[model samples]
Target: AQTVTQSQPEMSVQEAETVTLSCTYDTSESDYYLFWYKQPPSRQMILVIRQEAYKQQNATENRFSVNFQKAAKSFSLKISDSQLGDAAMYFCAYTDSGGYQKVTFGIGTKLQVIP
Candidate 1:
């Protein structure tokens, strides 16, 4: 059984600054996908960014980007130009591109954007 680990219990980023959230996973499968999901206190899980295992390029969405290291199985999320609205609990998720897929999530990192 594989699992995701988040070393940081909480993180704070000043408005207009940038912050990087660390995420690492353990897995034996070759083909899979990594995702960064943001869950606000009053909102549902939202897909922030995703990366394909085979893709060489790191996935990015607007101010959100991923530092995906396939060899080390590390998928970190970098939020640029942080804002108060960006404050949320970020979760790293994983799912294989095969039958009977199961989604695994990390504990989560609580992000605070201080104005």
Candidate 2:
């Protein structure tokens, strides 16, 4: 079985600052996919970024990027130039490479943007 772990239960950052959320996983499969999802107060799951295990390059989107260490099975999300809207629960998720399937999510880290 595979599992995702987010060490920090809560994180806070000032607007325009940068923050990194830690995430580590345990998996035996060689091929899989990793994802970071954001859920605001609205409770809607939104895909923030994704990384393919087979790819060596880290994935990034706008101000969000990932530090993917395949050998260590660690994937962390870095948020640069943070904004107030970035305040939410960030969840690390994983899915098998077989096909479109359900994802396993971590407990999540709540991010607070301090004014």
Candidate 3:
């Protein structure tokens, strides 16, 4: 079974600074996908970024980027130029290439943007 691990239970950052959240996973499958989802106070799960296990390059979107280490089965999210609106609960998820695939999420890391 694939399981995502988020060692950090909570993190805080200044409104205009950058913060990186750590995430690690254990999977036996060679091919799979990793994702980072953000759930704001509205309780909506928004996709932040995604990375394929076969791909060597990391993925980035605007102020968000990922450090994907396939060999170590580690995937982390970095938020640059953090803003007050960025405060939310970030979750790391994993899915494998199989029928009726289900996403497994970590406990989550609560990010607090300090003004």
- Candidate 3 lDDT score relative to the true structure: 0.95
lDDT of 2 by residue, 7-92 (tens): 99999999999999999999889999999999999999899999999999999999999999999999999999999999999999
Backbone-clash count (model 2): 0
Better of 1 and 3 by lDDT: 3
lDDT (0 to 1) per candidate: 0.94, 0.96, 0.95
Candidate 3, residue 51: CA error in Å?
0.6
Q: What is the per-residue lDDT of model 1 for residues 13-89, given as tens digits with 9 covering 90 to 100?
A: 99999999999999999999999999998879998999999998999899999999999999999999999999999
Model 1 bad stretches (over 4 Å): none
Per lDDT, the best of the predicted structures is: 2
A best-first ranking of the candidates according to their lDDT comes to 2, 3, 1
TM-score for predicted model 1 compared with the true structure:
0.97
Q: How many backbone clashes does candidate 3 have?
A: 0
Put down candidate 3 lDDT per residue, 1-115, tens digits, no spaces.
Answer: 7889999999999998999999999988998999999999999999999998999999999999999998888899999999999999999999998858799999999999999
Clashes of 1: 0
Q: Every model's Cα RMSD, please?
A: 0.8, 0.8, 0.7
